[model samples]
Target: MKKSLVLLFIIITHQAYSQSVAKYSNEFMNIGVDAAAFGMGNAVVANINDVNSGYWNPAGLIGLEDKQMALMHSSYFANIALYDYAAFAMPIDDRSAWGISLIRFGVDDILNTTQLIDSQGNIDFNRISLFSTADYGITFSYARKLPVQGLNYGINAKVIRRIIGDFASSWGFGFDLGIQFKHKDWKFGLMARDITTTFNTWSIDEDLFSAVSDQIPTQDLPETTEITIPKLQFGVARSFTFSYDYTLTAEVDLNMRFAETNDIISTSFASITPAVGLQFAYTDLVFLRAGVGNFQNENNFGSESLTFQPNIGIGFKYKGIQVDYALTDIGDQSAAVYSNVFSLKIDWSLFR
Candidate 1:
């Protein structure tokens, strides 16, 4: 009865918060890996031996025993091209662990346009072209178990880069901090991402020209512009087991904008999401999971629509090799069809 009440409270509170504001980033990273979505985003506390822990919650790495590695890839709708992530984690000693991860997101075949000017110094024609943009991040992470109790904490420092064809490129840095605790059958976790508001400054090249009496003369043009990416995110999750193989988990997350930036469009409005998921495992080798969150709410669109919902996943393991897959809809216009994503993950550990 207590568990049921707690779950109800989480749902009601999240719904109330979701109505206030709605916006999120790293949408590609949020679809989540296979095993995680199944656990209702409870990975911070649930992950035990998964290599993707580098992305989910680095603090979880503290429990790792052997060197672990994983690769994951997914495809988004409209050929938007999503992220490919790879991570590696190893124990530095009995009390410490270190990890590294790489992620890449790219858009293929984007149309580029250029304005054509006539001798009269007036626009004549528009030229259509094609180009691509890519974003990548490399992360270094470390974690340690606290001596006071069953607590674990970690941090990740990342170097981020963005590229837009041959015209522009920018660089920046960011960080993530996380904590996890587990005792008996109860688990708790929290993580704050993008703690530092980082931005990529681009260097632009411009050729200036002045028109006088139908004659054009070239002039000096300043090159470069600075654009900032605001940072904010906080997530918490808890889980309880009903038996050895059956478990339920709940997660709540809040995303806020930096006070320094107030532009509505430029600023990501604060939003909250809460989710519930169920897991069924058979002898720990095979598992099935499902979850639902932010379904039919106005902040995400309207109460009549569902954004994140009905996620399902499966996993299989043999020896030290693990494979997982998940399917989910991330609230796109064509979510029922094109917005769906298929994810694949592979994990290998040298020791059990």
Candidate 2:
């Protein structure tokens, strides 16, 4: 049964590989990073100020006080897939900051059963082998405070890499732009992902592909070029201080995609999904966070119903090192079950 399922997956994946202007291409990049952000429903664009900013809204990097680094890991699909992220950032002078980040999502140790049945129609378990599929994203980011005291802007140059065992591979590139403004306790942010459409060119190993070709004689070679469109994220946040020892921050964000989908708000020209997050801190050392996002309309038979994902997290900071953990997809609104995400952030100043 498992071998049959694997064969089906390979066939479907190959069929979908002939892509042009594909929607949800390079989707692994959208899964997000940092347990703190995950706990906050990924709504930190306006007030982010750490190494992780390289993945959210680079403009937020301007708030970094010193050199920093971060790492995060999460598992999905009942531990069948793994997601990992790492980042580094440092301030340049008083008004600029630069960062680099990497993300990897992969499913490993899959039984390649394309040859499970021998040419003579005999079943041979030894013909099975193992392979893996993975996607990676690396980003270089820079942020600078504008002359307008409260404004800042950032840019990202991204490189995307993907591989499917020894069968295929691809490389892609893209850019992102972000801006942020702060006034009193209010913060606003905008992030244009793939500001210019991203492109990925694929290369298939014909030698290994011959096996698949033999199975599907009618299948043609997959297309080489794949395109990803742009998406926009807007955020607003406010901080409230309750006494000298306690504080709370609330943020709301909207993700706009150019194509219509099952998001809460959809139209022919665009679709909008909203998310909200909240964080409470005590003297900036301990934190509690929560957020809800991924609002979608589900169809049951001929009826429609609303569903959303809820995430919660906690954090601890000592000196300049912070650790965070989050429980996401609490209600399993999506296909994947709940996942535990953990992240670590280090401030170089702590060691200095």
Worst 10 residues of 2 by lDDT: 214-223
For each candidate, give its TM-score against the true structure.
Answer: 0.69, 0.94
How well does candidate 1 score on lDDT at residue 78?
A: 58
Extract clashing residue pairs from model 1: 112-129, 296-305
Q: Could you give candidate 1's per-residue lDDT for residues 153-198 as a string of tens digits?
A: 8888878766656544656666777777777655566666666644
The per-model lDDT (C-alpha) reads: 0.55, 0.89
Q: Would you list the clashing residue pairs of candidate 2?
A: none
Give the TM-score (vs. native) of candidate 1.
0.69
Q: What is the lDDT of candidate 1?
A: 0.55
Clashes within 3 Å, all models in order: 2, 0
lDDT of 2 by residue, 9-123 (tens): 5564664464445766788898999999999999988988789889999998999999999999999878888999999999998999999999999888877887777889898
Winner by lDDT: 2
